[model samples]
Target: MSPKASKPLVPAKTDPAAIRNFCIIAHIDHGKSTLADRMLQLTGVVQPRDMKAQYLDRMDIERERGITIKSQAVRMPWEYAGETFAFHMIDTPGHVDFSYEVSRSLAACEGALLLVDAAQGIEAQTLANLYLAMEHELAIIPVLNKIDLPAAMPEKYAEELAHLIGCEPEDVLRVSGKTGEGVDALLDRIVEEIPAPVGQPDAPARAMIFDSVYDTYRGVVTFVRVVDGQLGHREKIQMMSTGVTHELLEIGVSSPEPEATKGLSVGEVGYLITGVKDVRQSKVGDTVTSANKPAEAIIGGYEDPKPMVFSGLFPIDGSDFPVLREALEKLQLNDAALNFEPETSTALGFGFRVGFLGLLHLEITRERLEQEYNLDLISTAPNVVYQVTAEDGEVLTVTNPSEFPEGKILEIREPVVDATIIVPAEYIGAVMELCQSRRGQLEGMDYLSEERVEIRYKMPLAEIVFDFFDQLKSRTKGYASLNWQAEGEQAADLVKVDILLQGDKVDAFSAITHRDHAYAYGVKMASKLKDLIPRQQFEVPIQAAIGSRIIARENIRAIRKDVLSKCYGGDISRKRKLLEKQKEGKKRMKMVGTVEVPQEAFIAALSSDEGNAKEKTKK
Candidate 1:
């Protein structure tokens, strides 16, 4: 350990050949974290008794959800084949939503371990991430994981991966993340197959901030991989992107735990504490170098993230607005993909229109807010950006319904996506039927193997924004996996349908739907609302209308009152007067009766009872 905190933990003269920078890439639930834990145990960095599952997954929410929301980097030393080597392992996220960030950060790695489940064969994300690895020209070593299981089919999956990656099936190494079977071979392969990082230690320090998180006391701590030279403590550094300068307070590496390193040198991955408060200054993919002697060339950064799914997020209590804002800021420090802006809703009042990479990303953000920040939130239905060409020829990109102009639009174009689904051949017809029912156009279909097929469809983004994935899973018995990307834009007959209670539009319950499905959707929405809303003294009309053209209506019948009691000693004229008086009183009460809509109903309106569209089911 260096007392000065400005020196490298290892010698500055350490050889680049001794360091291997690699990341583990796998599809979700394919044992990525489990494998990393095994590596830690094998390296003697953590004892077996002290070891826990998913050791690198540090967040409580991440541990509970069994998902990796972000990437993590760690350094450990190992000796193999009579030579000492240092492994800088990056545990990348397995979700499709975070794949782009992982890809961009892959530039920092010399190679990647492509983990595939033997029983599941090839999946949509497996292929998707494999292509991304190839795009970056990463040395990908296919590892057939879960080989110890009774249902494991390592031989078959090896062939599937080999066919896709153009490698010999025998070259795919088999390992069981659970029982540690053949893990030694996998480790040896990492050192042998993955090349040493190439960098010039004599040159000026140049590092890429692959990930960053905010600490209350430390400000912003950025995780970086040194491309060249060395970074020292108390050194003034400049962010190439923001052109901002700051002092490096501390430098260290996560050896499964944060350990103080004097600084990071060439071919090393570690954390840099720059005392940066605003996360915007320490952006992911930004170049960091010494301010006194900066690098000549700046590292090319990743493209700005584009959020495809849009929804409004509001605190359950309006008084918690400021609290929610602070929570968002803190959360944003860990997630650069989350985009939000303040907006007002007539029905929900003050709130924000938040944008997410996908539906899963939307759900994760909401969960973090509720569980971590302890703030109750209400999120409106998720929607996609629409290009509206007005009657007067003006064009607008509408994300929120409140932003819609009052006039009739000549054309409204919604976003479309290229979706690839991989499932067993038996379920092909079911998936095809579901896609077609959602107005999907078949793009291509090909046989990956005798019993497996890949089905590609071009479908409107709005169609799958809510229940499509759920339906696909149910239809295929959870065997189907999907990957989607935005395919430019397409024209559609779209209308914004508003839910009216007592003839007043509720903006929070409004949604844009295709005109062809408006009748059925409207009828279902009106019916669902009628059931959710409590009955009042007067009959309340729950109607779904398209710009005042009522398409579906459901009425909540008023409770009948037997107000006339037996007239013991009164004549027929007295009974008539009593009935007339009771009728007048009923009319007065009807005028004053108010329908109080509960918070649950507003949140429930975001998705249908069939499936959760706005939120992902907790897996």
Candidate 2:
């Protein structure tokens, strides 16, 4: 017999004790989504025919990439010990860039399924997420997934997971997300192990908005976890953060699908649709309360995510700026970590300097904007924030290379991160060598097992922001996993490399690199611009320089129109005079000539294609 009933499990006024709120946390491609599908099937929330791989991953980009970018919440019904329980399961993204989403999900849940791939054992990100879960004091249910794989060492990994989580080896549950073996028992274990949420049911209506998304047809759809009291449909709700009130047009729970609910009470998770079209009004981590009877205190919200990578995102067509703004506003509602501000580039035109958590975050955001909003965009090279201390005893924050202070005769501090890498013991030498090459300082190393080793390093953010991860994976033969967090900033010998075209500085091509690599960076950039920028009517000198010192230079020779071609039998003096006239005209043109860098050139030069190609060649 099935473990779950065919009908809806929870009543309208169900007791809070019967609700179990939890999330599944794992490393990238560790079967979190597949396990989620199995649970939904076991609970019969999604019928067999309607089921698809990565059901929780709704966007095409997510489905294609086979990675969860957003945390999806679903309510499943399970019969545990003759009691029908409503399980609010949040399947979170496992990538390091999306850790902010996991953190937000943890705040709403009481437990997390710490899933380890039995074939791969524990990874660096797995440990990082485990620490986050522990910080939240959530019950940790150790789960070993992919047990059916040929290389799966369930017993070995079970012990590894047990050692990490301070649990017994046998206590680690084994399950195959693909075949659905042992999933039913895992569900029952969730009921037994995870605690029910605790909230005051008698207080004024209060719900914590963990996430919100902008819907074209429905306006701003906010996902909230009811912390106390009850919120019903058509009630006027006020945002505790903004004090803005709006009518709740719809209230419902996602049983893998949006099913209308009359109201949401304490400990229940549901979505709310307010008539307000503005995405800013419904903020994530904001408290929602009844406008008439407001709650006394707001829930402690999540700390704002600090953006680690900054890049310029400009529309290929200038007219799409407003559309890009609207799209960014909507995307921000979905991804709260994304930050942007208006900035103008002389070469790239008007655009926004967007901040992302990492390279993947920047890529995903750009792709989403292009795919979802139908806007063509040109993105500049990704960079990390730097602190420039001037000789005047003032510190300035620089996000873009163009903003690097001029005449700065003081220290430059660059952001650094404490990076943790887990790899096979044999690859330790290669990993260490790669780290050292990127100016990484070894902090510590430990043996996770007889064959697996964990290495910690403190590295500058700018060094790894480009291709460090790729290099690590290549050096380790894809057996290594990495996780990192900001470790403040350290003073570094850094210089800003400015790209000048015909003696004019191009802000879009400027970059801040370590002093040691400034020459190489300048040379490469100047060479690339020489290939990208077309030959002008006058000779254009592409120079990469630091202050008055020219480190590297490339020249785009002018398109010469032969004056002698028209003169068949001219006198030598006449030819000389004509050549002199031509030379003088060229000099005059060079003086007044303004190099117009084509849009394609800007796109090609700024794109990550060259960097990726270099990484590929290294691999």
Candidate 3:
């Protein structure tokens, strides 16, 4: 027999007159998902026994990663001001990489529950999202979460919210998502404060697709906010992107509980059943209009964000190329943030130069590709956008090494980033030192609390492209949180450093370097490349050069005696088999005439270990 399910604490249904459509927005780990889970339980949408930490993050990878990667919707009926109403709650992603996804979720709602950590207070991302909500004209309801913690400072946070977001201090609701303290009051405020979405239900079916994900069994499951009309199951719908029409196989409103009702109406947030198998077909930010009477096109439905960082992602093993490509394709079907193309590497092998929103985004994508898809990949170092002035007086955006200007350029500009870091007050000195070490200029600092400070800095996007966070975490004992935004371009004396392994330039290992650190960086790169490239039949020269000047060079001595010293007599087939295997392996190596350059030589050239080790030695 199956285990008995627990009964919901609150009644299943309440008066529908008090309904409110709102979403919870916060920086990562600020308790948005947890608060949603608590609200669902309090509203009887989910039972107490069935409660999970982040129920909205149903994806296995999300649960393991402890981050909400996608936006999730749920409905709950509650009572407020002597009236019953349905509350459609959307839980949005906090990371800036998913800013587009968050915007889509906000478009579906009329109000937002901005969750701020009581102890940590407002962060850069929190402020950014608040501005986004204001741009959308959504009613912002500030909530101070984690009030039950010993370090909680609800009053201070309330004041900050009022000052930062222009919301009244008294209007900020203090609630503990952990202990459920003051949670019901928040629910009541939601119904009282948030306005009901106004729209006619009889108009032609017009829905906005805020987000979409691919399902193996369900095809494309699109989350939409019905804007103008009522949609019914089996109704024909036209997607704005491809103009391909598809019928709604199913229509349903999501609840914290699985047994919720189906078929949602106007002003309600729910899912549509597009029989289309590809998620890309139902692009997020597209419009779904009635096939019979489509209205004047949905304006600004979805605008693709330009990728700011680019890098090559290749399989560690040549044989895994096919599997890696399949994995990326599958990931793209679910994540619109990831973009890539087929690319070739002289040292690393076949791969794709994938573009991402930011450094964090790149890391998350790489981690997901490896963990979810079970593929091993070699990633090129991340690169920021560079403005190159050509000899013809035309400015070009160069992201890849191949696109860089080949002639003497007039000037080179790199993208600068405004970075904000929050850390414990005791670690302020260390954090400052760390930032300065990365060529960062201190902007300003603010004391968030007696023991915590938020430091602002202007840094080159190229500085933090690698494991800067790891260094910060180590220095601050994992207490520092970083947030940054592109701050346009800055004139820099920068040069493209081309790395050559076995005399041939490895484009994937190339980088834009500051003139001050060119020599050091070149030596470090050459050393690393020497380690990554395997020994071949001939000695390989690893060189790093800026234009015509060679700054650093390392050599991998040829295998002085790779030839077999002795051969067993009469075992001609065994000897032949060994020789053929060696020959095939040698053929895989890129040959510059008689010289065979192994793949490892290319990878070592890009490793950060060489630079890190040199820095340690200098210290």
- lDDT (10s digit) by residue, model 3, range 1-619: 1112362222222222345889989999899988987888898977877877888898777898899888888878787667678889989999877787788788888999999999878876787788789888998888999998899988988987887777688888999998889999998888778888876666776788887878787687888877777666677889866789988776666775333233556687777777688888888888888888875657363567668789888887789889888898888888887889888866667889898988767878888888887876667788888999988899998878767888878888888888889887899999999899888999999986576687999999888877787899899888888877779888989888888766677677788888897888889777765665567665678889988778899987766444455774767787777778776665455364344444454444444556643443333
Cα shift from native, residue 508, model 2 (Å)? 0.9
Residue ranges of candidate 2 with Cα displaced over 4 Å: 1-11, 561-581, 611-619
Best by lDDT: 2
**Pairs with steric clashes in candidate 2:** none
Two-way lDDT contest, 2 vs 3, winner: 2
Q: Flag regions of model 1 displaced more than 4 Å.
A: 1-8, 566-594, 610-619
Worst 10 residues of 1 by lDDT: 610-619
Listed in order, each prediction's TM-score against the native is: 0.93, 0.93, 0.83
Clash count, one per candidate: 2, 0, 15
Candidate 1 has a TM-score of 0.93
TM-score-better candidate, 2 vs 3: 2
Error of 2 at 557 (Å): 3.2
